[model samples]
Structures are given as C-alpha cells and as structure tokens.
Target: MMTTIAAARSAGATRWTLTSLSLSMLLSSLGTSIANVGLPTLSEAFNAPFQSVQWVVIAYLLAITALIVSVGRLGDITGRRRLLLIGIGLFTLASALCAVAPTLNLLITARALQGLGAAIMMALTLAFVSDAVPKPRIGRAMGMLGTMSAIGTAMGPTLGGLLIYGFGWRAIFLITVPLGLLTGWLAYRWLPADSAKSGARRSGFDVPGTLMLVVMLTAYGLAMTIGRGSFGWLNSALLVFAGVALWMFVSIEKRVASPLIHLEMFRDPDLSACLAMSALVTMVMMATLVVGPFYLSEALELDAVGVGLVMSVGPLGAALTGVPAGRVVDRFGARRMTVSGLAAMVIGCFALSITPAEFGIGGYVVAVAVITSGYALFQTANNTAVMADVIADQRGVISGLLNLSRNLGLVSGAAALGAVFALASRSVGSNLAHPDAIAHGMQTTFAVALMLMGMALVIALRRLKAHGR
Candidate 1:
C-alpha cells in the first residue's frame, strides 16, 4: 500500500511538472506570435512609423537569440528551478509593463526584458523533461512541448485579434499576466528542487565566451534583419563583426575552465550531424512562410481571408501531429523516425515543386499539410534524440544550442530564401512581377527548397549509419 501510494503521488507530481513546463513553452511562443498582430495597432497608438514599431517584434527576437545559451548555462551553474521561477516572474512583470507603457521605446525595452525571461523559460523547459519524466517516455514529453508550441503559435493571432477587437491592444499583453502568474505558482509547487551536486560540478562560469557568443549572435541577427529584406553595407559590416566575434568566442571557449559549449562536442559526428540537419531542415521550412503568401496572393489571386485560412494549415497540421509523432518515435526509435520524417518532407517538397498552379489552394494545402506533418515528426524525433541521452549537467546548454540552430535557420530563411524567391520572380517590391512570373517563382523557390531538403535527407542517412542503424 505504501509503495503504491508513493508511486501514485510521484506520478501526480510528474503530471503537474509537465503542465508547468508546457505552459512555459506556450507563453514564450505566445509572446512572439501575439505581439506580431499588435504591430499595426502599436504604430497608431504611439504615432510611430512601421520601421520604429517593428522594433517591438525585433527586440524580443534579438534578446532571445543573444541570451538563450547564456541563460541556459546560468541555469546549469545556478539552479534551473530557481532561475525558471525568476524567469516566469520577470516575464509576468514585463508583460504588465508592456501593457502600460506610454511610449514605443518603453514598450520595446519591456519586450526585451520579456525576451530575457522567455530565453530562460525556453532553454530550461526542455532541460527539465529528463527530471520530470522517464527516459522511455522522452519522445512523448518532447512532443507535448512541441504541441504546446504549435498551439501557442496557432492561437496567438486569432486570440490577439479577438482581444484587440474587444478590448484594444493592451488586453493582449494584459492577458498573459494572469497566465504567467499561474505558471509561476505551478512551477514553484511542482518542479523538483535543484540538486546541489549538479551546481557543485561546475567550477566557474564562462563569462567571456558567453559575452562573445551574445555579440556574435546579436550581430548575425542584426545583419540578417536590419535591412528590411534588402542587404546593405551596414549588414555587411555586421556580418564582418559577427565573424570576428565567432573567432573570439572559440578562443575564449578553448581556454575557459567551464565552457558554455563543449568545444570537443563538435567532434562527435552525431552532434555535428544533428545540428546541421536541423538548421537545414528549418531553413527549408521557412520558405513556406516567406514565399507561400506571395504565391497565394499574386499568383492565385487569394483575398486576405483566403490567404490566411490556407496559410494556417501548416500550424494546424503541426499541432495535430506532434503527439502522434512523439508516440511513433517512442515505438520505432528516434533514428528511424528521423529519417522517415525527412523522407516525408522530401516527397512533400517534390510534390510542391511540380504542383500545378491551376489547382491553387487545394494543391498548396495538401503539399503544406504533408510538409508540416513531416516537420512535426522530424522536430519531435530530433529533439528527443538530442535530449534523451544528454547528461543532467549539460542539458540546459544543449537545449539552448538546439533552439539557437532553429532561430538561425529562421533568420537565414527569411533573408536568403526570401531573396531567392524575389530574385527568381523578378519582383522588385510588392507584386511588381506578373502573375505568371509569381507562379514560376513559387516553382523555383520550392525547387530550391526541395534541394535543401535533399541535403538534409543525406545528412540524416549518414547520421543513421554513424549510429549503426
């Protein structure tokens, strides 16, 4: 009876622990998506130009990219549970500030602070899974997190639109405050206390490496984003600075007693392969977001509502498939599932590449659904493979690295792949190219996207071989 009762209580605690972590993922993703819908409203409220109001979104993203890994390392050295609580609190407070800020600059500053909290939340949530769940079930746990992310992404715009329509823009920010508070309480109540042994294992923090990485990542993000889809000299200068920062970071990491990332980890073929494959996969995934809207609007003549409903199919598919993918990963093994997912993506991309323009939304939706379902599986399997075997001490930083690779892919996709579409279509600004030109552009972009997916598939196969699959 005692053993049974103890087991039951333990299971209950695990459930709540996962609930808190899922909420953390949801809130962080929600922060990103919700704020995007408010940009126009914010511009009018503050009487600022689109470029200035755009910083509201950019600030949050830059902060996350720049600080995610550092915060993850901080969680390792300090206490993940404690740091997570502080992160939830900080995010909550920042959201309140954003709700009340009278100026755009103040709102931007608050958004950056919220991003810092989000970085901690995003980095630490995955790290906590090993603590909260069994090894056999890691895939399912990862899938749950992915599902939350999908749900958050899917819900944000619609939720924001409803809130803004009913109560104005501030309501969107105000709404998160209560959710954050609840998440904080759940975390404090359910999450395991930090192990003293884990904290004692580290001799010191790698301050210099952390700073250099922040500089490198920030410079890279700015270089990709600052020009509004057009590269400039400023972008070139930032890239150069980023290159220098990368060198400095490597040098610092080599000498640090406790490094943020294990320099030698790159020597592991599996680690290198997974990172590269993830970056490549996400880069291709971004093409749909960047190019799909243009194809629908210009080539197919979809109105705003039609375009939105079709574009939503991807996130909806992801949300629906995430848990099932996780279950499949657990049953079939991560390596096999990873490769299978890539194969599915390749087929989807190939179909999209040759899809007839006359089929319009039907063809586009089918291809997108297939692609996103594959993505949902790939993301779950890849994340499980990385996190399942990671040591407790290294979990936070590794999680950060995984998230960082995805962000870099997104940034690059928006810049590089978007450029590929624009140049191929001969479109200058907004719809300067003819309808036929836009249709040709869609075909060209997916052809390039398919090639990228092929490369990722090759990487996945090699990784499978390396692991003796």
Candidate 2:
C-alpha cells in the first residue's frame, strides 16, 4: 500500500513537471508569434511606416537568434531550473513593460527583453525533458511540446485580433503576463531542483566564444532581413561581416578551455544533419506564415478576418497532428519517421504549388494542412533524434542550437522567401497588385519551397543510410 502511494505521487509529480515545460514552450512560441497580428495597429498607433514599425517583430526574432545559444550554455553552467524561473519572471515583466510603452522604441526594447526571457525559456524546456522523461517516452514528450507550440502559434493571430479589438494592442502583450506568471509558478513548484554543484558548474563560462556568436548571429539576421525585398550593399556588407564573425568565433572556440560550443560536436553526422534539416524545414514552415497571408488577402480576396481564420488552419493542423506524429516517431523510430515526414512535406509542397488557383481557399487550406501535418511529424522526429542521445551536461546547449536554427530559418524565410514572392508577383510592396500576379507569386514561392524541402529530404535520407536504418 505504501509503495502504491509513493508511485502515484511520483507519477503526479512527473505529470506536473511535463505540464510546466509545456507551458513554458507555449509561452516561448507565443512570444514569437503573437505580436505579428498587431503590426498594422502598431504602425498606425506610432505613425510609422511598415519598414520602421516592423522592428517590433524583428527585434524579438533578432534577440532570440542572438541570445538563445548563450543562455543555453549559461543554463548548463548555472542551474537550469533557477535560470528558467528568472526567464519566466523576466518575460512577464517585459510583457507588462511592452503593454505600457509610450513610444515605438520603448516597445521594441521591451520586446527584446521579452525575447531574452523567451530565449531562456525555449532553450531549457526541451532540456528538462531528458531529465523528466524516460528515454522510451521522449518522442511522446516532444510531440506534446510540439502540440503546445502549435496551439500557441495558432492561438496568436486570432487571440491577438480579439484582444486588439476588445482592449487594444496592449492587451495582446498584457495577456502573456498572467500566462507567464502561471508558467513561472508551475516551473518553480514542480521542476527538479538543480543537482548539487559539480563539474558542470565549475567549468568556466566561455565569454569570448559566446560574444562572437552573438555578433555573428546578429549580423546574419540583419543581413537576411533588411532592405525589404531588395538586397543591397548594406546587406552584402553585413553578410560578409557575419562570415568574418563566424571565422572568429570558430577560432575562439578552438582555443577556449570551456567553449560555448564544442566544434567537435558538429562532427556527429546525425547531430549535424538534424541541425541543418531543422533550419531548412523551419524555413519552409515559415514560408506558410510569410506567404499565406499575402496569397489569401490578394489572390483569394479574403478580408482581414477571413484571412486570419484561413491562416490559422496550418497551425491548427499541426496542433492536431503533433501527438500522433510523436507516437509515430516512437513506434517507427525517428529515422524512418523523419524520412516519411519529409516525403509528406514534399507532396504538400507540390500540392500547394500546383493546386489551381481556381480551387480557391479550400484548396489552399488543404495544402496548408498537409504541409503543417508533415511538419509536425518532421519536427517531433527530428527533435527526438537530436535530443535522444545528448549527454546530460550538454542537453541545454544542444536544445539551444536546435531552437537557434529554427529561429534563423524563420528570420530568413520572412526575408528571402518573401523576396521571392515579391519578385515573382512583380509586386514588391504594392498592395494593389493584380490577383493573377499574387497567384503567380504563390505558385512560384512554393515551387522554390519545394526545392528547399527536397534538399532537406536528401539530408534525412543520407542520415538514414549512414545509420544503416
């Protein structure tokens, strides 16, 4: 009887721990997505152009891109649970600050702080899973986290729209405050306390390597993002500078006794493949966000509300498929599921590209659903493959790298793929572009996206062959 009671208590604690991590994952993804719906309102409120006002979104992405890895390593050095608590607190506080900001600059700065908190939260949530979950169940746990992520993403636009209508744009930021607070409390009350200090803590933090990575990521983000659809001298300079920073970062990492990232880790083909595939897949995933809105609004003549509803369908599909996808990963193994997911994505890409525009929103939504469903599978399997074998001390940094790749992909997709659409439509920034032109843009962009997915498929296949799976 005592054994039964102890076992039940342990099960309950594990459930709560997983719940806490899911909330953190949800909040981090929310921070990434929710602000996008309010961009137009923000532009009007601040009397700013689209270019200037976009900093609201750009700032958050850039902050995550630049800081996620550093924070991951920091979590490894410090205590993950302790730092996660701080991250949740900071995110909540920043959301409140964002709610009250009187100027665009202040709002952007606050968003950056929120992103910092989000970076820490995002990095550590998956890292906690290896500790909280048995190896046999990691795939299911990943899938659950993936579901929360999809829920948060799908919730963002609609929830933001309602909030903006009911209370104002500030409400969008304000809502997260309570959610963040709840997440923080759950994490504090349930997560495993950091193990007593040992070599993990004693290792010196790699300041130089971390700083150089920040510079590299910052430069790359700006390079990919700036100048609207047109690449220019400034973007070129930034890209070159980013390359230099990478070289410097590598040099510093080789010399550092305690590196922010061990270069040797990249030699693991599975790890490297997962990282690369994640970025590529996420870039394609982000194309849905960047291109879907424009296509629905322009080619399909959807009103703002109608467009928002249709846009949510992709993430909704992802949300619905997440747990099932994770189960599939566990049953079939990550390697098989990974390849199968990419194949499904390849089909979705082709469907989206070739589905006649005459079929309208129905066809588009179906294609989006297919793509997102495949993405959920791909993401769950890929994350499982990456995290399944990481050493305990390295889990935090590995998770951070996974997230950083995804963020960079998102940032790139917003720029590069958007540019492809703009050029294909011959519309650039014109809202008045003809419906036919918009339709053509949609097709062209997806065709390019199809090629990107093909690349990812090749990578996954190679990994499978290498493992003789």
Candidate 3:
C-alpha cells in the first residue's frame, strides 16, 4: 500500500512539474516581446523620444544579460525550486510596478526589475525541465518548451496591439500580473523540493567575480547602446570601461575557487562552437525584430493592429517548426540541422536585403517567416547540443551561459542594427516625412544583416567541420 501511494505521488509530481515550468517559460518569454508593439504608444504617453523609450526594452535586456549567469550559479548553490519561486513572485510584483509607473524613468526601472526576475526564470527553466523529464523524452520536452516560448513571443505584438487599442500602453504590463501570480503559486506547490545535490552548503558564491561580470556586461551594453548619433562609436567611454572590466573579470575568475563562470568550459570545441552559433543566430533574429515593425509602420503605413499581425508571422513560423525541429535534432543530430538552418537564414537575409520596395507587406512577411523558421531549427538543435555536451552537475551554469549568449545577442543586435538604420537614414537626411529615405535606411540595414548572416553561416560550417559530422 505504501509503495502504491509513493508511485501515485511520483506520477502526480511529474505531471505538474512540466506544466508549471511551461507557464513560467510562457510568461517570461511574453515579457521579452510584448512591449515592442507599444513602443510608439509609450513614447507618446511619456512624451519622450524614441531613443529614450527604447530603454524600456534595453534596460530589461541589459539587466537579464548581466545577472543571468550569477543567478544561475545562485540556483546551483541555493536551490532551483527556491530560486524559481522567488523569480515568479518578483516578476509579478515588478509587472505591477511597470503598469503603475508614471514617468518613463520609473517605467524603465521597473522593467529592469522585471528583467531580473526573467533572468532567474530563464536560467533555470531548461535545467529544471531536464531534471524532471526522462532522458529519452528530453529532446521533445525541450522542443515543447521552445514552442511555448516562440508562441508567447510571437503572440506578443498582436496581444499588445489589442490591449493598447482597447485600454492603453499600460495594459501590456498589467496583463502579465495575473499570469505571473498564478504561475508562481503553481510553481511553489508543484515543483519538487531541492535535493541534497543542490550543494547549498558545499559551494561558495563568488562576489568579486560576479561584480566584475556585471560591470563588464553593463559597460559593453552601454557602449553598444550609445554607439550611434551624437555619441558616436569612437568617443564612448563605455568601451574603455568594458575593456577594463573584462580584463579584471578574467583575472578574478582565474583566482576564485568557485568562479561565476567556469572559464574552462569554453575549451571544449563543441561547446564553444554551439555557444558562438547561438549568439550569432540570435543576433540575426533581434536585428529583424527591431527593424521589422518600424519598416512595416512607416514604409507600408500599417496601423498598430496591422503591424502586430505582420510581425507575428516570424514567431508563428518558429512556433510551428519548433517541435518538428526538436525531433529532427534527436534523430539526425545537431550538426546537419544547424548547418541547414543557418543556410536558410542566410538565404532569408539575402532575400530581404534585395527585395524591391514595391513587394510591400507580403514580401516582407515571407522573408521574416523564413528567417524565423531557420531560427527555430538552429536554436533547438544547438540548444540540445549544448545540453548534451555538458555534465549533469554543470547544467545550471551552462543553462545560464546559454541564456547569457542569447541576451547578449539580443541587446547587441538591437543596438548595432538600429545604429546602422539610424546612420543610413541620416545619410539620406533625417526627415521622418521622407519615405524614400526610410526605405533606403531599411534596405541598407538588411544588407548589413545579410552580411552578418553570411558570416554566421561560415561559423556554422566551421562548427560542423570541427565536429566532423
């Protein structure tokens, strides 16, 4: 009778664990893309410039990028379940703060806090899922997680538009409040308790290393943010700060007993290749995301709803492909899928760059969908490879590192690609009324993206060769 009861309890826990994790993944991923549709509304409401309002997005991403690794390491030391619960609670509260914020500054601050919560959640969701699911089904589970994230992200623009149209820009932030709270409650109840293997008492947090990493990431992100306009790339002090912080961080990591990042992890050629490919692919995705809405709104004269629908195409494509791609990864291995996906992205980028302005919304939709489909394939395969390469005990930190790569790509891609568009627009005269100039700028930006994608393809090819598969 005791054995039967134990089996029933175990079965119950298994069922609820994935559901809770998926909810957390959906909310966190939703936050990343939801605000995008409201960017113009936010600028108008706060009476701020586009550049200032962009921080609503940037601050969130920067906070996530800077803290993900540390928080993941913390999860390793404390307990993943504990950290996940705290993350959900914090995220819910921060979403409330964001909705209520009066000033643009306060909104950005709240978003940063929201990002901190997201970092914790993002760092652990995969690790938790991997731990809970059986080995044979891990690939499918990851694919499903990816699908949830893709759906959430893809749905963001449409949802945000509808909310903004019905309520206001604040509605975007407010909507997450209920979802986050419910997820938190479920997580607290459903997630299994931390085991002795969590190493809570065995490991020590690396304070100096953590601090240096924050400084480095902050400086680097700031440099990228301010690289354009009056600041210009050459005169930014943030670059020097980034350089100094990086040197100090490397030095400190070498001396620390338990570094925030295990530097030696990069020595594995497979791991390094997977990480690099992840960053580059994510960079391409962000470039499209940042530029696509503007192009649709300005070039095609689309309304908020129209823009949202159009932007949804890419993520929708990714969502559809995610599960199938995961199965492919499980069967055929990562190298082939990664290479094919990168090639597809390269083709998509090239198509977008050369597409005639006359092709309008339809052409753009096709291009974006192709890009996202490629991303879905590449991400699933590469993520699976990354997890496969690392040891079981190191999953937490490695998950953190993987998320770090993605966020870095996100932040850098937005800044750099936005800068390219800004400069190109300036070259054609910065008049917002000039459709020709805007078109020119958009084309130039995509051309640059094409070049970057080509480079990524080369890297993927090299990675494939290195693995000899």
Stretches off by above 4 angstroms in model 2 are: 198-203, 427-432
Candidate with best TM-score: 1
List ranges where model 3 is wrong by over 4 Å: 1-15, 39-54, 102-106, 226-230, 233-235, 301-304, 424-436
Q: What's the lDDT for all of these models?
A: 0.90, 0.90, 0.84
Q: What is the TM-score of each candidate against the true structure?
A: 0.97, 0.97, 0.90
Which residue pairs clash within candidate 2?
none
| Candidate 2's TM-score | 0.97
- TM-score, cand. 1 vs. native: 0.97
Sort all candidates by TM-score, best to worst.
1, 2, 3
The better candidate by TM-score, 1 or 2, is: 1
Q: Give the TM-score of candidate 3.
A: 0.90
- RMSD (CA, angstroms), candidate 2: 1.8
Model 2 per-residue lDDT at 457: 98
Provide the lDDT at 336 for model 1.
Answer: 88
Residue lDDT tens for model 2, 200-295? 565678999999999999999999988876799999999999999999999999998989999999998888899999989988998888888888
- Across 1-469, the per-residue lDDT of candidate 3 in tens digits comes to 9999999988788778878888888988999889977899998998898989989988887888889888888888888898889999999999999999989999999999999999898888877866787665666667777888998998887788889999999999999999998899888888878888776544578899999999999888877765334456553688798899999999999999888888988898778877877887788888787778778888788997798778778888989998898888778877788888888898888888888668998899888888898988888877777776456556778899998888888767877788788788778886854666667777888898888778778877887787688
Over 4 Å off, model 1: 199-203, 427-433
